[model samples]
Target: MATKRLMKEYNSIQKALSDTQEYENIVSLEPTGDLFSWCGVIRGPSNSPFQAGTWKIKIEVPQNYPIAPPKMKFVNKLCHPNVNFQTGEICLDILQNQWTPAWTLLTTMSAILLLLQDPEPTSPLNIDISNLLKSGDIKAYNGLIRFYTHKYAIDSV
Candidate 1:
């Protein structure tokens, strides 16, 4: 029997899948184990250094779900402050201790999208990249981000 929490998370995922916007660039989801765990994809935003790139990510819903945000990691190569290059582990506030029960999958996805736009250098998973991002050298930063985008992100169809 499914617990009420799992059912709510399932519903939230369903709603997010249905209402997702095109520009959001999230590809799809597939079950990895039970109803709570899934593998997903999100395309990099356009007009940024990551434009024309697609990155695969994994989403693991916790047993507590909404009360504790889902864990997400990139399955593809990535170079960013909030994302670990080796493990693809992400560092995001909402996904950690600050998570709130009212947050939905859509909101989580939006946060991921925004992270791609502005990575948090203060709390960084990739220290080198974080330092570069903090240096105020826009050209170098764009170049580095673009290089990683080409190495990891895929072209959209």
Candidate 2:
């Protein structure tokens, strides 16, 4: 049986998708059985080492979604402080215990976009990358990101 919370979440997600202006390279939702999942394609921000690159991500909602936050990860290789190298798991506060009942799919997506724009090194999934980003070595950071962007993001195309 579908709970009221689940129904509301489903409806909200559907409405957001229909209402939002679709970006050429951005996140989108796909239906799977009775559940729904999101597939996100983010264009690297300008001036960032990942610029001109595209990265794919996946957001998997649990059966008890809403009550528990959805899981998100990059489908393609991503070298970021908050993203896991092997599993693609993202380390975002919203997806963890900090999740609130008022948060919606749109809010979560917006947070992700913001994270790409300005990553938080304090709480990161990639320790080395996080340390580098915190060290304020912009050149090295850009170099490493560019290297991965080329090796994993661009070369795949």
Candidate 3:
């Protein structure tokens, strides 16, 4: 049952990515050896500071997933308040304590996409970046983010 559910979810994700006309940002989603693990690339949202960056992400689905949230982390470096600069740990409630079985991989991915655009400063993983964001230095904060994005997330092709 667990494998079946995981496969179903994986298929749905692949289907959604394949239908690129309807979706944006997400560039590719490929299973890494198994249905439970995947690697994806997302082009930064066009309207954001992250624009032109192609970020890589790693997703690991637990055997008891749905009941427990899947582990999602950025594979490339990101300078965001809500993300751990070194570990890439995300500070999102839904991926942690607020997770519910009703949420699917697609929903989680969507949340991550939204997060890139709107990070929550109050519940931040990187205090320094959060301080920069809240210190009324929008230009400086965005500059750092854009710099890191270009340094680590630029697509090879």
Best by TM-score: 3
TM-score of model 2 (CA atoms): 0.78
Which is the better candidate, 2 or 3, if ranked by TM-score? 3
lDDT of 2 by residue, 13-100 (tens): 6666667664323435444455556565667766677787777777777777677887888878888888898888888888898998
Q: Is candidate 1 or candidate 3 better by TM-score?
A: 3
Ranking of predictions according to TM-score: 3, 1, 2
Residue 73 of model 1, lDDT score: 82
Q: Write the per-residue lDDT of candidate 1 for residues 38-152, one digit (tens) a residue.
A: 7777777877888878887778887766667788888888778898899999888888887888776656766887898988899998998888888878788889989988876
Query: To one decimal, what is the Cα RMSD in angstroms of model 1 from the true structure?
Result: 2.7
Q: Tell me the TM-score of each prediction against the true structure.
A: 0.84, 0.78, 0.92
Ranking by lDDT: 3, 1, 2
For candidate 2, give the lDDT.
0.74
Model-by-model lDDT, in order?
0.76, 0.74, 0.83
Considering summed lDDT, which 10 consecutive residues are worst modelled in model 1? Answer: 1-10
| lDDT of candidate 3 over 25-90, digit per residue (tens) | 777776789878977777888898889988778989888887889899988888888999998888
